[model samples]
Target: MLEQYVRKILTARVYDVAEETPLQSAYQLSQRLGNSILLKREDLQPVFSFKIRGAYNKIAQLSEAEKARGVVTASAGNHAQGVALAAKHLGIKATIVMPKTTPEIKVKAVRARGARVVLHGDAFPESLAHSLRLVEEKGFVYIHPYDDPDVIAGQGTVAMEILRQHQGALHAVFVPCGGGGLIAGVAAYIKYVRPEIKVIGVEPEDSNCLQAAMAAGERVSLPQVGLFADGVAVSQIGEHTFAVCRDYVDEVITVSSDEICAAMKDIYDDTRSITEPSGALAVAGIKKYVARSAIKDQNLVAIDSGANVNFDRLRHVAERAELGEQREAIIAVTIPENPGSFKRFCEAIGKRQITEFNYRFHSKEQAHIFVGVQTHPELDPRSELLKQLDEAGFPVIDLTENELAKLHIRHMVGGHNDAVINERLYRFEFPERPGALFNFLNKLGGHWNISMFHYRNHGAAEGRVLAALQVPDDEMHLVPEAFNSIGYPYWDETDNPAYKLFLAQ
Candidate 1:
């Protein structure tokens, strides 16, 4: 079977549409990991993905009769673009059935390639079912995204290019696994040509079809799949692809969504190019492998599969990147509720950057503060920070790995605090510097109780803060005077409808 795949890969006709992407060296990642890291730039294909290789190969080899009958396929992402472009190049009528929920940009891209677009259900499965129906009704040849032998063979060409590009002492190659087609193809080719090199597969933890199949010793379907890395979000591995992978692939690694975000940032920092979550899987897997094995001075390769990410998703990616890299620590700390306690806590925290700060005056004895602090993976780890906080007599709860805290709790920290009375909410913009929060707290002083406070560093020139202070009715006139003395831009949000609806006491 391996030999047959090897022969097909060598003769694969993908070049008519897909270009041989470069295996570029990742300098910063190499230096950080102590390994020679290289990235297979499959994201640079004409359709901005490796799916083009397989799609073109499958369509180009069809019989004249089949071509005349036309082709149909279902995809909500890169595969849709790949099939559309390939069929257009081959002068064959291609009908692409995509989920109605798919981004308009993607639908436009397929239609731009001259494929008749059929917007079906809200998800891929529904689109796939509709496409199959079209195949039977219209006599259209259905193009399997990752299951067909021709498709797998075309994807194998990626491994062929890698071996030819860098004919050296390669240790292992990391490939992102979806329906297993890309890895199956690359694994078969590599195992046949250079059996010494390990072919490792990477998958999102929530969408690990290959790993589950390998464990079950057969194809096992997941009840549901995660859509974060939508390109590789397969519930079950393809039968043909899995057959090849079961023997050829060495190991599979699963990574969290945060790790994928971190890997995407790493790719962007090195290549100045962004990748979709799935495209960063191989890189994320390589990071975990290096950390686990502690291997050094070995050649590692990561397949960057695609670059079809939406623009709005970058905010979420950036927010989680530091945490994924173990460079940020989130903790809930208990401090004294007395005046100047915020300043004291900052002093205990030392000079390390505070990424986030949230506090609400709940009791006179103690205060709960949700804080995000920056830490280095090697020099000043999260454990050391926790130790420092403990030594300072500050009770702390590590929320670094708490998905609930990270995703929702952080934003919902201070809402409708009935204990907060006579609260005057004010929004401030302070100079974004190391001691800015401490300085602001010091100026605000022990005069009044701080009812609610929130500060998040957004890497902007100025840090945005929302704080509410408790003051007597007579001291209302002094509020503006105190803020003016602090010398920072401020706005009174006491009557802001959003505050009244969500947070007013």
Candidate 2:
């Protein structure tokens, strides 16, 4: 079965538009990790992603009758552009169905590639359902993003290119896994040709379909996927891709969102390229793998998959990268409200640059300061600094690894305590669309009074809401039912340390 895929990959017709991207050296990262690192620059494609290779390959094999009918596919981002570009080149009409929650930048990009864009569904699964309907109704050929044999074979060309580019003894190759198309293709080819070179699949911890599939010994559908790495936010692994990975891929590494952001910064620092979160998955995996094994002095390669990032998303990446890499530490310190107390605290911090500092006069005796302190990558300097403050009888809380504090509470301080009773806080994530908030309120807020609300758009597929509600003891039991009826996943943030410190009742 694997040998058949190897032969097909060798003959995949992708060079018509997809160029063989360079496998360049990442010297800075190599030096840091004590290993020679090579980055497979798939982001350099004309379509700015590796999807073009697979999309074109699948469409190129179409019969004349199929070409006449044209092609249709559902994708929220890169795959849509790939199919559109391929369709344009072959003079075949293409229609792309995308989630309405897809960023405007991506929607515009698909249209620019000469494809008719259909905005439907709030998420990928919904868009996929709509696209499948088009296939039955209009008789259009559906170019699946990753599952098809031809698509997997086309993506396998990446491995072919990598083997040809480097003649050295390669230790391992890391590929980012979404629907598992790229890794399946790459693994099929690599395992056949260079069996010793491990092909590791990398995924976001929240969207780890490949990992789950491997563990279950079958394809498993995830209940939900993280949107931060939108490119690889797939809930289920493709059946064909999973079969290849299970037999060929060595391991699947899952990294946190912050780790991905840190990897993005690393890529930017080494090659001056800012990759999307999914694109940086392999890099993040490499760092995690090296940390796990403490492996060094070997040649490791990572596929830098795509670069189609929205301009506005960079700000969030920049803010989180330092913390992701442990180059900065966020600490909440409580010091006396006296004038000399501020000076004493600053003196203890020494010469390290303060990334952020926020404080407000809460009382006459004490004030809480949300501080960001710079630290080295090798050692956590926050520990020693924290000890000094603790010995001096200052209260401190390390907010470095706190997700809630990082996401919502950091931006929210100094607005706590109210006359309104039973202030229950819940963090809600809902599909962002017109009147989404109105719908949320109408569905879940008629019986309860909203006490506090905080929302800021990140220009992604979903919106996050942090709200305080006044729910009586009797109504507390109904809270779960109300949220269930509303159909949005939520976390009770009322007991969170940051909430307790800053805004709890």
Candidate 3:
């Protein structure tokens, strides 16, 4: 089985459209991990993903009659781009059926390559079904994204390049897994050539089709997959790909969404390049493996699979990266409502940089504060911080691992307080800088009671804040004048429907 794949991979005609992307050294990651870390830069391919290698290889090998009939496939994004570009190169009319939920940028990318784009149902399964129907109706060949033997052989070229590029000591190669195509191809080639070097597959925990299959000893479909790592959000492993992976692959590692984000940041820090969440899976797995096995001084390679992530998604990635790395701790601490109590709590926290702070005056006796503090996994761990706060007589609830607290509670800490009467909500945008919030608050003059406040720093040029001030109906006209004096751009959100539903009285 492996011999056949090895032969096909050796003669795979992927270079026609895909580049032999460099296996670049991850210098920073190497130093930190105490191992020589190499990144297989598949993100540098023509389609910005390794999917092109298989897509082009399969399409190019078709008979003249099949080429004339054209080809069709379904993809959420990355594979669609690869098929579109490969067909255009061969002068074949290609039709790509993509989920309606696919990003417009990807839809445009496919169309840009002169492929007809059919925006179908809400997800890949739906679109895939539609593409198969097109295959039967139009007599066009359907290019399977991962299941085909030729496609698997095409992806095997990645492992071929890795072995040739670094003919030195290599402990393992981490491949990101979706439908098992890349891992299947990579594992087959590596085991046949360098059996000593481990072939490990990395997957998102919530979307781990390959890992699930390995456990089941057969292909198994997940009820649903998380869309965070959308590129690898496959529900089932490909049948052909799984057959190779089940035997050839040594191990499969799963990483969480937060870990994936941290790996993305780590890759960016080393290479100054951004990769999609799925692209960073191998690195995340490497981190988990190293931490678990306590391995050191070995050569490990991680496949930086693709860079098709949307720019807007970076904000969420940035926010979660710290928490994923165990570098940030979120806690809800109860402090006395006395004037100097907040100051005393700050003194207790001591020297640590506060990433965020949210407080509300729920009662006259005590206040619940949601705070984010910088922590290190080794030096100043969350346990130590909790100990210190406890020693200082501050009752704290560690919300670091609380999903509800991190996702929604942090933002909705002080919402719709009946006691916060005569409240007028205003959203403010100020230049982000040290003491900017302090200055803004100082300018407010402390005339009216600040009933509610919400602020989160997103590492942006501008700092946005949502705050409500208690102002009588008669004094409402003076609110805009006071904001004008503050000189920050402000919006009246008191009447905003979202505010009314969630935060307003």
Candidate 4:
């Protein structure tokens, strides 16, 4: 069988190539999973990925004539760097055609390794097509990212290392699946060496090409690929890689983008290394599988595949991580548009910090406001808060359950209020501890009324409170003076662009 041949090659070549990555036991994950859990640290490889092993092995196995002719490949990021560095080591010319949207860091890394870089097309498929055309035009050898046997055998080395390190004690291995190359290689080697060790492939639910292909009994193409996990956002699995996966992989599971982000954050918290969403797949998969299967006493291994993520993207990851874990909730509360009704609602939410508050008074009949609240980690407090709101006769809609809340409504809050003729907007920088906002509210005295307010507690040096205060026309200048007396820096929003933009909306 092909598994035997793959094992033989993996044992001989892959071990010789990528022998340095560690199979480190994760103390945090093992405790959480209720069994021994180990992380195969492929992210620690020189290229920050396992791609170099496959790319180098594939290039090395090519004939002397092929090496003389040079090679060309297409990748969104990591694979391009791998092939570029490998070709540079072999002293052969290499061309990498990448998507125009590829991160600047990746493009620079590929060029630094002496590969000619071409930015073509909007996505990976178009870049792959362009690379194929280049191969035809320039007569350079085409090195596929995952399809070839040499590449599969090279990736098999990861499984070889895991087996050698764990010595057959592992119950299951979680591998991230893209074009199916990584899982295919790992599954083939593990099934050959230790048939009892289950090999499972993890994929983003948005791009489960392998799962769909397995069900259809043929290679299947998704209509669209999600770019969030650009590393493994392949639309279709390769034929050879799919065959290996079908034969050896025990099961394929899918996880959400939020889950992937949370998993990536977990990995970062434990290892202090940022993992790309694709790299976090194995961790996300294990989480999903454990939750669904209710298996508490089984040893598992999750492969931490790559760490080539853009630093700026971490903001988005952190934002969604809580949502993935169900720690933070976005909700809307419909309160009576009266004077103390808002205050009563605020009082009802004792101790719970309001992450966001958006209000609009459409007419005298109704006042609708969307609120996002951050609760304690245990969601029981949220449940109690909800019950209290219900008892107070306020209609609450859990915007956390609404897609619009998650995507747009939470950010789109402030708007112009023509009725606020006597009101002024002020931006206050205050400390983020509990009761800070309430303390500021209490200090306002009976003279000023809060007509509108927006505040979200981000763990920063300080908390920003955007509030619209309605005071007597004569008392307008007292706003800043009062805040300054209390040691709070206040900025008038009359000339601020962000204030105007929010108000104009």
Candidate whose lDDT is highest? 2
* Model 2 error, position 149 (Å): 0.7
Q: In angstroms, what RMSD does candidate 1 have relative to the true structure?
A: 12.4
Candidate 4 on 211-294: residue-level lDDT in tens?
Answer: 999888889899766657778888899988988887788899998888898898878777887898899999999988887887
Lowest lDDT block of 10, candidate 4: 496-505
Model 1, 1-505: lDDT tens digits are: 9999999999999998899999999999999999999999999999999999999999998999999999999998889999999999999999999877677778899999999999887567899999999999999999999999999999999999999998999999999999988999999999999999999999999899999999999999997676678899899999999999999899999999899999999999899999999999999999999999999999999999999887877887899999999999988888887888888888888999999988776567877778999999998899999998899889888888865466545785664677778898777866554567998988886668887777765433345677789988999998888898887777787875445534578
**Given candidate 3, what's the lDDT at residue 98?**
88
Clashing pairs in 2: none
Candidate number with greatest TM-score: 2
Off by over 4 Å in 3: 415-505
Model 3 agreement with the true structure over 377-410: per-residue lDDT tens digits: 9989999999999999998888887654565456
Count of clashes, each model: 0, 0, 0, 1
Q: Over 4 Å off in model 1, which ranges?
A: 415-505
Model 3 C-alpha lDDT versus the unseen true structure: 0.87
Q: What is the lDDT of residue 381 in candidate 2?
A: 66
* Candidate 4: count of backbone clashes, pairs at least 3 residues apart or interchain: 1
